[model samples]
Target: MPVTRANAMSKENKKVAVIGAGIIGMAVASCLQRDGHDIFVVDPNEPGLGASFGNAGVFGTSSVAPMSMPGAIRQVPKWLSDPYGPLAVRWSYLPFIAGWLARYIAAGRPDRVERQARALRDMLGRAVDNLAPLVEAAEATAVFHRNGSLFIYRSAEGFAKDRQTWDLRARNGVQWEELDAAALRQFEPSLSSNCTYGILVRTNGHTSNPHALVTCLAQNLIKRGATIHRTAAIGFVLDGDRLRAIRTTQGEIPVDAAVVAAGAFSRPLSRQLGDRLPLETERGYHIMISDPEVRPKVPIADQEAKFVATPMDTGLRLAGTVELAGLNAPPNWERSRILLHQARGLFPALRDNYPEDRLSLWMGHRPSLPDSLPVIDRSKRSPDVFYAFGHGHVGMASSGMTGMVLADLIAGRRPTIDITPFRANRFA
Candidate 1:
């Protein structure tokens, strides 16, 4: 179901508290403001500087495949053995995440994968179109780019191995042009000669600076009379089936309705509302090269390495990797460093040596569910309180549609898309 701006059932304005100032939170606040709601955004840190700050910046409209795909279980042992592989699990945290791992493997069943892909397509198919107005309203249009993205493979056999995944995308209405070695070079000459095959997804795009784009959206909300609370939401004060206020580190703030969009920290809040959902952090890492000798015209993803090299306003960002280490673990800078080695293989012209000052490394938590779908339904304890977190890797690309759907739910209107798959108690 494509997203559209449907009118609310009632025009009565409500004071809404949106917890978390990340991309998803800001987008929800913006959409609620458009519906004439008094918006209060709550977060201790500066907006968009969380996981939203360090994403690959891809619009990823064609990314309907779940992280746990068919035949994914067979490769987990290999990925875990390799320290520098795309996937790694901290041995100490295995006990904490074993239940999650079981569910993740279960989601890879062929039947489940098909259903998840359809639901993801419905939620993500028109992300850019849904976000265009918000980007324009924020006056941050310059940060947005629609140059499209390329997924390059190192060998013909490598491309052949991924036929099922590509077929899945095609079945879900994702369009792409297959490029052979010669055509791939003609399309993006900066790529390494070893890149023998490619899939050009024309519908995909990326942001030049994701942090700036989200900050601008937050600023726009402020200018339009929304309040920004520089405090963390600790709990909720509920009266029967309705929420009276949100308890925060600073103090309690009264609100007619509330949305929990606190990214990786949303599980505890949902637990307080009596829904103990299964959520974990997929710690992601990235490296930014300030001045690279070669820059791709569009974002290029190495199919084999599972990382994306995207041209950003600040620099060329090489972002990807999944570390199943819980929050509070020390930063593994080695994960970030591995991306630099992978980037050199994709872009041969890039300088082999760069000054220490020219490199920027970061690690952030991607709030993920085992099944790869977010929980977007109302809390079991209260209808005035809604849940919207666990977007995993697609949070940046799907934030706009998720916000619009939440606004519709809060305003007593049916969402344009069927949200049955995103129920909060599905795991139960």
Candidate 2:
């Protein structure tokens, strides 16, 4: 496959080390490779086994609304009170996260939310288009489905409550159609009749298998002369604001430039580069049911329950939830159980109990920021060192564009979108 230079600037190629093998890291590598850069990826774990492996897989182009929307704080107290609620926080971790919570709440102010939404729209709106080239290169185009997604509500009141969010999406050029009970049922017969309202974002799409998609891209990179280092990136060896090489557990690997796409583990590396970002882990969980009796035709998000039921090649994936328990906390299986209970309610045909072999549960940390935006900028200390983490919940959907933008920055070309909102020093 010939690399496309339409988005490339100078033909100069350099040794680029992408730190992290998740979807974001691989996507960045793919774009850099497309621009003819010598690329290598670094990670300790198997590629794509982190949050990218277990996300809902929705392209979520319409998901421009920041997580910290207006009136979101009022519901936090109620959400915290419920153990099985969509949001949870380990009480012990609250003190450590208090400052982040404050900033999160402040980000919800109407003015800030508007700016955040526009920025998110610019990046996520072209998700599928941006990812098309990489998907083609990987020969995994079949892994993606453009059948659209549903946001169904159990009651008219619940639907009305989200009007502002829908309005925000509309203002950001997101196209969606309102569906009543009959229409919702006709669109997704597998859903329970309790869902009375829905909004179909026809422009959105989803990956049938996120892990496979990322692995294919990684494999493609390797086939194209890129290397994958199965080791942890500990630090960097710098020479007066220029990255000389990356320090790893195994030893140092010389590189002309580096990217910190390490997801939840990127904070310390950023701090090492003189950028103290307020990056936190929003621990998310998912349950996969293999050979489900019933599955939605497309991804369906229960607006009130705050989880998504996505039909995947492996089976049906019920994924969503925000648990702020930090990165080191043990897995909370109870949260996975809550998803099972919610799934039964969403899909009445699903069995109350499934054999352990038929079910798989996962918990991974989503690298999140208070304002629900990612840091896709060069380091304050070195232009060669770029930051591309803190994507929060939309990493899979936004990875393609993030990669293109990073490649443009690295190649000294203008990014296709405005990246000011994603600057590392925004919090400062």
Candidate 3:
């Protein structure tokens, strides 16, 4: 937004071009437009319908923990061998993935893990508070549901393992309540007897339809005079220390400022601009059972398989797993089957949830950083270039806060939160 700068006479007219129409990009565009900047959003898809479309949609502030934790690095070998393991790296992709794994392994150190948690807390802690007003303005209150998320444990030992993470969440001021099996059954009457202790993160929420949320925001952006360009953000036209325009197949969209939020696709684009970001894609899969009539209102996080059962508008989505395969790979049905099997285990009634033909498959590569803290800092090398990608599994969770920070950066105001932790050069 063009705010009255300290140099009052020099009205800095800004034309902000956002790359990628994922929730992050859309949110940034929406925030900038709302703040009075001329806005344009460019992406291959119209808006949403990619990672933003099929995401689990959990608005989890409790996710201050990174994807690579203390013991996660050692599990890579086991995960690679086990088809149904929670994580995997394909052998064909090993050479490339190995580099990513090296970064991930270093991030698992105690000091790095602590920094990752703090940075994640900083990124996500104020996310909902900042973004909720924007959703309210869009007039799609129904899309954002505040029913909270429950983490159900399969055993008492599992519950103990859960405490380690929950303790971290609590330290960061995330509100939660420990619920025993009896308390869990009250809300999740459908849960099987095999599940016991649970942690109810009341601060959490989810989107019933993420596509609808992004669409509503996009529509609102258009109404507010922001242009939505249906084109892929292939690269950028580099000026000295800045990206003067975003390069797309349609043409170069000339601009004063560009925000690269192209998700996993951002690495190459950033690299071309001389910021070789440590961005990798965690390829994930989901199985959706369309419109299950009888469903629990709140979402469930299964501790056993590390998956999430989220009831959506069109269907109930079982989503999770972190596979470090390249983009454009075929959907792994084994992972999808593993999701259904986990769903059935958690909710015995789901065995007859839907017709086999009614099930749908989806695969998306969520852009991940070594620390799992998304990059939201300005490119140290380029003043006109900013980054908002690498949210990993928490894209939806952190999008709102990301947008707010982006708007602040663009408006040339001191951002409300410190940006040092999310700097793109942190890895370098």
Candidate 4:
């Protein structure tokens, strides 16, 4: 497999079309624009309002653990039975998701899990550091902060069960501190008494407002003279093995190269380029309380509850959960409600209710591959087409690195990091 440099597909003064206005697309556009390329962003939805708007906002530098791990298969039955559990699969959609599910479970094999973790470490270990320059350039330093993040366990047994995961994180060079009950209280006094153990990752950080960060990036890119088209990309116009233009709802727009970064909607578009990726939407839910009584000092994740409560600029956001329902299915707001319910256990003083206008319930699709890796390679069918979707739970965490590597690829330069694990045709 020979690497296709951007110069081989197009000249240096290239016009690149980025299909998506979310974090991934906007980041890619900003990097390209900085590299002196013409950038046009396409998206029918408002920029940053999808999953980017509602994530927990944690810049998880130590998030090297795969969601599918040893014994994960045994927990599936419990997740299926419990309506408010962290994972859910709509029975009607099981057949549609069965194949991906099989691959997901298989990825949990011990050897495969270790390989995935190593790849994640290389890809995400510097997430916050990689995004710092971009944050400064966008004048979004206020929105990005490094207060660190905490993972609390309710009992010794629970913490012990995850020893393997902790070991893997250590192997990946993740820095962490173990805290007992008294220390946990000193770190976050608002935490419930049930949280007896804690692991603090000082390298982790989060955004004050996830949506604002992305919007700021887009605004900064526009101010830099990047063109943005508020329309959906329907397909691509190709000349032999090269992409000639993108056919959007608005009209055909010529381009030198194109990238599919449309989040969950990227699957169909990638198939247009002949990459049959096993992409699935992991529908995530979030509940925001604008006037919460108690706010955690930083982001806090309850090991048992499987939700993360982060203090945002506007309010406290409780976000987590994985639902496997196709793209067109209506949101199950009940999942958001479950987040609220479990969040109260983490912060005992949280109010039971808030003004209807002060609370927001949101559900967005997270584009995920079975092995929890994103495709960041040029298309096998056409080097003029590239992929940068399927970051799954870490899209926000890994967006900056993804953009940097993408820009490097587009500039006909090898990425500083080896991206073989993220090849677009790995499923082949």
Residue-level lDDT tens digits of model 1 in 1-428: 11111333243688889999999999999999999998888999999989999999999899999999989888888877887689988899999999999999999999999999998998889988888899999998999987789999998899889888888888999999989999999999898999999989988889989999999999999999888878999999999888888999887888888999999999989999999999999999999999778778899999899999999998999999999889999989999999988888999887776898999999999999999999999999999999989999999999999999999998899999999999998899
- lDDT for predicted candidate 2 compared with the true structure: 0.91
Each candidate: what lDDT? 0.91, 0.91, 0.81, 0.89
Q: Candidate 3 regions off by >4 Å?
A: 1-10, 352-354
Q: Write down the TM-score of every candidate.
A: 0.97, 0.97, 0.94, 0.96
> Where does the lowest 10-residue lDDT sum fall in candidate 1?
1-10
| Residue-wise C-alpha lDDT for candidate 2, range 1-428, written one tens digit per residue | 11122243243888889999999999999999999998878999989998899999999999899999999889988987887789999899999899999999999999999999999999899888888889999999889888889998988899889989989988999998989999988888888889888889888889999999999999999999898988999999899988778889888888788999999999999998899989999998999999999878889998888999999999999998999989999989888878989988888999989999999999999999999999999999988899999999899999999999999998899998999999999998
User: What TM-score does prediction 2 earn?
Assistant: 0.97
Candidate 4, 347-386: lDDT as tens digits: 8888777778989999989989999999999987788999
Per-residue lDDT tens digits for candidate 3, residues 1-428, read 22112222223557888888889988888888878777778877878877888888899878898777777666667766776778866768888877777888888887787777887888788666666888998887998887688888987788886566666767777888878889878877898888987889877888988889999999999888788887887877776776667778887777778899888888877887678887888988888987663476878898777889998888889899877778866767778778887788788877644577779888888988877888887776678988999989899988988998998988888888778888888877
Task: Itemize residue pairs with steric clashes in candidate 2.
Answer: none
**In terms of TM-score, how similar is model 1 to the real structure?**
0.97
Better of 2 and 3 by lDDT: 2
